[model samples]
Target: MANLIFPSDFEWGAATAAYQIEGAAAEDGKGKSIWDTFTHQKGNILNNDTGDIACDHYHRYQEDIALMKEIGLDTYRFSISWPRVLPAGKGKVNQKGIDFYKRLVNQLLEAGIKPAATLYHWDLPEQLQLKGGWENRDTIYYFQEYAELMYSELGDLVPRWITHNEPFVVSMVGNLFGEHAPGYQDYNKALQVAHNLLVSHGLAVDSFRESGIKGEIGITLNLNHVYAKTDSKEDQQAKDYCDAFNNRWFLDPVFKAKYPTKLLALYQDKFGGFEIETGDMEIISREIDFLGINYYSRAVVEYAEDELLKHKTIKPEQAIYTAMNWEVYPDGLRDLLIRLNKEYTDKEIFITENGAAFADQLAADGQVHDQPRVDYLREHFKAAYQAIEAGVPLAGYYVWSLLDNFEWAFGYSKRFGIIHVDYQNQQQRTLKDSAKMFKQVIADNGLTD
Candidate 1:
């Protein structure tokens, strides 16, 4: 293969969530988040692991920022812990929490790296969860307040802001499937939660505008291309439904300003309707600066009469799989990007989260030789470059993480970072082979095979 070239202005960065990395669960006046409460429940998370001290990023953000600089990152995307900023979820502000983020942003700026801050990454304050969480319409107002506070405090320092990360996962995984924090298994509630999350996104964007902040704001969505298992009509129908549920369910409202009618009809019988309040769609459709896409793999769907969505995912036998059991399909990224550029709004797109989790190990040389990850990233970068050449307005790409932190329900079992973090040995950080390759890619503004 020839060298893969990227735009000179293409942004290179790494991303991490607050709860997944900033493990100061109970320090500096930080209140407990739903994850803190959820992980405390027995048998909730794998290996009974919690993020109490995951990466200790709360105390070592400077060191982490230094590592990011060493990796030649142009930007660093991280989430702000809602509970940390507002201990009770609203009203009084936590000055200590505010100071921490301010310090982190300043350090990144001093290091010549741009800061991209995500307002909410599913770490809703436990108190807010007690008040019905995202399902409760009131949470939207709380989110707006939180967003405004952050913007007022660090809006000038951070150039890029993401309102929410993967609202579909927050709804389906956390609410419907009961796999994440504030777990519940009610379809009706899940639909409501999904709506509320979108509403909060719009509200946050509105707040950003009202603040006169000179920065870009958008929401990050986890999207996948859905493919039919066969040419049969049933399989095609399954693919259509799965695409709507996984991608359009969130995409349409933001870009098209309305929920996909087919999905609405499919769920109407169970819940009567989406219960979309008047003017909710208008708020949800507020124009934004850009769109953040988190692509992983394509979904191969086959018709399944017994499944609620009438779809079943089937992994190809010959395909490579990630530690998360996702197929390693780089073409899916190109397809998804082109589809988004053509079907959705022609807004700027950023690959806010991409990278695979693999079982990485530290060799005797005190280095992590994660070749699989390096290959995964290279293929995906090539895919992204193909999309760019094909006319997608992809502005940047941020790898999934900067360090291997807590992997939510899977705990710390999955490693998705180019840089390895030894959780046992005082959170020792080591740059894996992938990190060195990424540094070269960043420096060259492309991959030189």
Candidate 2:
């Protein structure tokens, strides 16, 4: 198993989002986020699961940090709750909400674990959505204000910060495609949200600099190394659509400051443009210090006339699938890293999230045998190392999660954590196999000898 050693300076961390982990949906005067309303709607969430209590990380954060210490994690990347802090999206600051994060960050620092903070993870304040969500331009300004507030408070302690997580899924998939919260089903509207999110990202980035914040700033994107299901002309077009859907939609605007030509054709005639504010790209394209990437699996595209999305989607393939039914294509990891290096060419990269979910069950002895997840981590870690060998500047790898929290629409059912959570008693601990493997890997610093 030990083939390629990780760089001695490589970072080893784990990730978690706000809504997915920090439950207490209505505690301490926290405002409702889009996800709060979405889960309330009939059929919006599986088993009508909501993050009302989640892992209760809000209350059990100390216990969670203890678990991280047990597993020997170096860093813990988590997101801040936007609505929870600014109830109406930007008027009054909730000291209570701010206090929650202060405690979490201090605990991590005390534990000798680096804290990586993501500004937004799609838990937009419902008040903002009511005022038109990402479709409205004002949200960007509001987000800048929120980022400034966060940096003013915690920038001294937390050294790493991420602006937003995967606009492709939240703005396009959630709002545009009507699959997630603040749900709407208009392609043009989705573009508006996507553009606005980037605008907000730039504003936040600038806010970080103007405030003289310390440490690094970046964004987390869910990039899919997509491929055409076949060589036919139609299939190629399908793949092209997939590219627009997955990679180009976010990357083109962020890196090149231009929308993908094909993607523009699909919406420019309908919606004007999102990141059109002057001097915004100067911030968006600013020399960032690092990049965080969340890679789950490969997505194949074949022609499909869907009702909402209306192009193509993942097709049947003979690859192993995750519990979420995503195909496990290790090469896609290496491919994406190479492309990112070629594209950005200016920032360091971190595999912020790379983990698989399977139907895991606690055994009679209270341990879960997760060989699939072990194989996934091993292979992708090597893929990351391959990217490093190819000069990708790949710096670290963080498993998708430290604990299995709420999986949004899928709720608590989908487990992606190295540590399992017993929701009943709010007990948290680590799995035997994955924890053991991770400890040795961290101790060795790399799989290679």
Leading candidate by lDDT: 1
lDDT of 2: 0.83
Give lDDT per model, in order. Answer: 0.94, 0.83
> 63-100 in candidate 1: lDDT tens per residue?
99999999999999999999999999998899999999
Candidate 2 residue lDDT tens string, 1-449: 54777777888888999899888999998999999999989898899999888888899899888878877889999999998889888999999999999999999999999999999999999999889988889988999999999999999999999999988888877976687887788876777788788888988887888888779998888888877777988777777777777887777767887677866765656566444667755556655678778898877777766522344666465678899988888889999999889976557888889998888878888898889988888888888888898989987788988888889778888999888887775465556577678877887786744
Query: Which clashing pairs does model 1 show?
Result: none
Task: Show where candidate 2 strays beyond 4 Å.
Answer: 232-234, 270-283, 303-311, 314-316
Candidate 1 ranges beyond 4 A from true positions: none
User: Candidate 1, after superposition: displacement of residue 332 in Å?
Assistant: 0.2
Cα RMSDs of all predictions? Answer: 0.8, 2.2
